[model samples]
Target chain A: MHRIALQTLLFHRAKVAAALAGVAFATALMIIQIGLYEGLRSRASVLVNRLGGDLWIMAAGTSMVDDSELLATGAELPARAHPCVTSVRPAIVAWVPYRTPAGARHTLQLVGSDLRTAGPTHAYVPWSFAEGLPQDLLAQDRVAIDDGDLSRLGLAPPLVGSTLEIAERRVEVRGVTTGIRNVSLIPMVFADVETARTLAGAAPDGATYWLVDLADGSCGPSVARAIERDPRLDVMTREELASVTEEHVVTESGAGAALAFVALLGLVVGTVIVGQTLLSLVREHHKELGMLRAVGASRSELAQFVAWLSAFVAAMGGALGVILALLVQSGLGGRSVELHYGPGAILTGLAAVLVMCTVAGAASLASVLRLDVVKVLQ
Target chain B: MTDERGASANVLEARGVVFTHGTPPLETRVLHGVDLDIAPGELTVLMGPSGSGKTTLISILAGLLRPTRGRVVLGGSEISAMDDAEVTAVRRRTLGFVFQAFHLFPALTATDNVAEVLALSGTPIRVAREKARALLTRFGLEARLDHRPGELSAGQRQRVAIARAIVTSPRLVIADEPTVALDGPTAASVMELLREYVSAGTSVVLVTHDVRLVRASDRVVALEDGRVAYDGRGLAANPHGAPSGHDIHPPTPRSSEPVAGPEGA
Candidate 1:
């Protein structure tokens, strides 16, 4: 039965190729869409995830890392007073309007932290410099911009010393980083605390968040509770903040829903492609199928043949789709739009293709089972 | 249920078979009360003109269709009363078929096409192919074993179909116009192979309109206007034995012609 099924499918090479192309396209589309969604979620909680902190102290009701409100002056004091706290550093996350040297206007997500005092795991300041050192941001009126932001910010080859204005305060680009990104799709600017505060119109002592390092092996939840004594602030462990931020991006932002719909659309498109191919294949071979039935091929046998055909197409198409998705990810390497086709997303795509093929096979089996053996033989 | 001489058991017995198409006032009656018996170890040629229901009768005999009224017994089993699945099982185990168009699965090699029937009947693929290979080699298709139907000539394709039919060594072989598309020598060769099956005691029922093929048959049953017009041997078995410009049975009225119902049903 499998031999017949495979041979029959291969006999209609052009049609089977069309079905395979459609299946591969849909599978890659779904994988990429899901991957993009995951990339966005990861980007959304970038700061919360990458910062070397056991806990974060944010203004009350701050929903995500990118939308932090300015906390009271010295909000880090309460966290520092905790027995488990080894050090606490002020950090600021603020979005500011910027005018590039070329006079192009854009919004910039400014991140300010004292990277010198923070632990080595802290990436609040640009760790990978494309042109200059991380200490470049320590200079007065200086900010570090990522290589991805260079084209968007209208900064050409000579990135260093190119002056830009943020929130009406002129600043020079001292360093160019590589691969830093934000979900907001805005340029990311890293600077020291005072420069960020001055540009964002915050008081000298005011910070958007307080990054607290704990003594090695200290309980994070206990220390967070200690810092939560200040009613004007919300203290959470890094993991808790990252989770909440991801949830916010998925639920509140609506981007996740849109991406999920696209992923589902890929599935629906795949089903339609497979269904149409199966229908046409059965129709094309109606006389042949009837002859088989007349010659004593049972309905179950015919159904199995159809199933094997579908499985063949799906398995091959699924493997091709995974390869295509991986190629797409590789093609987009270091670009603004990040795609992460993890094992989970790839497996989901494969499973979805199988389901699509099964649905198509069952539909084709209807006509097979209803075949008129006598009429067909004639 | 036996032949005229009651020699051995009859391979098939059709008692008062009737087959109709459609329902009520719009119905088309294709076979009107057909009673036939086929003895083992003989070639019975079923002959009829267009719309005479010869195809319908063979289909009923093969259990591919059920008669409106009557019972068909094949190899001691009453097939007319069996449900589709049961009849199918019986057919798989006891019947072989050679169709007019050669209905070979176009995608499979000659060996695989012949092996398919054996495989369908629960034979392991490897063993089935071995048997198919041996059979096709006997049919002079040894050189064409790996070729698909499209790669073979009509004669070669028909040979493959024959191999597929007899692969299971069925008790009954039903062929419909098996040589209609073949040349003289090829058709003669096909007839010779079918005759071999008969000599082996496998009942062979062949449906054909050609009198040349009928002349070689052991017995011939001719149908006209949904009724049996003649059943005999030799000269009378000739389908065109009637006077020139005259039909054996009265010409059927145009209004009563079967409404193109499902294929041979």
Candidate 2:
């Protein structure tokens, strides 16, 4: 039976190739759409994921990391007084319009923090720099722009020492960072706390988040709960914030739903194409199947043969789709939307292909079972 | 027919078989109370025109279709009383069939076609292929063993089909117009092979329209309208002996003397 299945597929090379092509196209489409969705979710929560804070204190009603409601300057005073709290640093997040040398204006998110603070919360900022030292932002009116944002900022490579106007204050680009892209394509500029405060024209006490660090052996969840007792603030661990941000972006925004619909369409298209092809193959060989029955081949054995054929097509198509997706990702080279093919995405694609193939095989098997051996022989 | 001890020597027997087609208002009776027997080591030819129930009777005897009434016994087992799976198992183990179309799997080579039967019967693939190759070589298909059905001539394809049918060495071989699709020489060659199997103690029931097969057959059963018109031995003895309508009586032997003819003409 195995030999028969393989021979049947090999003998009808043209038909097999067409079926494989259909499956491959569908798999590629599904992978790309899901990959884009994952990429978007990952980027949407990039800052929350990268920030090394045991807990974040935000203004009440703040749902995502990008929600820019300012907390009072003394909001961290209560969290700092807790026995588990080790230190508290004020981090300011503000989106401000910057004017390039040519007078082209673009809105860029500004992250303000004191880089000299030797703690986990400040560690991620220095390590993220791709071209220059994080200490360079300490220079007067100095800031760093992400490598992906050079064009958006109307600046080119060799961007160090380039001057831009933000909130009517001239700031020097001192460093470049990579992998800091956001789904909104908004450029990010990292600046010192004082420079950001002066540029945004905010009072010295105004801040967006209070980055909290816990003492050794201190439980983060307990401390977060203790701090949440204050009614005017919302306290969350870094992981919780990342999770909430991802959920908020994926569900509240329509982009995720659109991508999910495309992926589902791909699954349906693949199943139909492969099922129709296999059904046609079975019909063409109806007489042969009848002869097999007359020669004592059981129905289960015939079904097994069809399943083997379906598996072969699916395996080939799956491999091809993965390769095609990787090639497309590489070709894009982070120019537009990012393509993230993480392990979760790959496994989901594989499982979808498996289900599609199994359904198609079962559909054709039903047709085979209904064939009348005596009538076909006649 | 029975021996002196009143014991049946036949390998297959049909008693009071009736077949009908279609539903009540459109019902058509094709076979009406037909009875026949095929003895061991003899070639029996079933002769009839189109729609004369020759194919219908063959299907019932082979267990491919159930008769509307009556029983068919093969090798002392009442096949008509068996369920479909049981009938299929019996056919797989005891009966071999060769059709007029020579239905060889188009994707398989000649050797594989023969080997398929052995494989289906649980023979290991390597051993099955070896046996298939040896059998095809005996049939003068050694050079064509690797050729697919589309690459083979009509006679070669028929030979392949014959080899496949006999690969498992069944007790009975049923052939329906096995030579109808071949030329004169090829047809004669195919018949010669069937005769060889008959001589080896295998019962052969051949359905055909060719008059030339009459001389080679040990018994001839002719049907006109759903019933036997003639049942006898030797074309010369039963020339123009077929009645115009149905005959229910058992045909009697004309004489004990054997008829003479060319053995392989």
Local accuracy of candidate 2 as per-residue lDDT tens digits, A66-135? 8867776678887778888887777777888888778988888888876778355455453477788877
Query: Candidate 1, which segments miss by more than 4 Å at Cα?
Result: A84-87, A103-105, A120-124, A133-142, A160-174, A213-231, B1-8, B23-29, B234-265
Worst 10 residues of 1 chain A by lDDT: A118-127
> What is candidate 2's CAPRI-style docking category based on DockQ?
medium
What are the candidates' interface root-mean-square deviations? 1.2, 1.4
lDDT of 1 by residue, B1-265 (tens): 3448874377787888899999999999998988777777778788889999998898899998889999998877899999998888888888888989988888889999988888887889999999999999999999999999999999999999999888888888999999999999999899888888788888888999887886567666678888876555433234444321222222222121222211212
lDDT of 1 by residue, A356-378 (tens): 88887777989888887777778
> What is candidate 2's lDDT per residue for B130-206, written digit by digit as tens?
99999999999999999999999999999999998888887788888998999999998998888888889888888
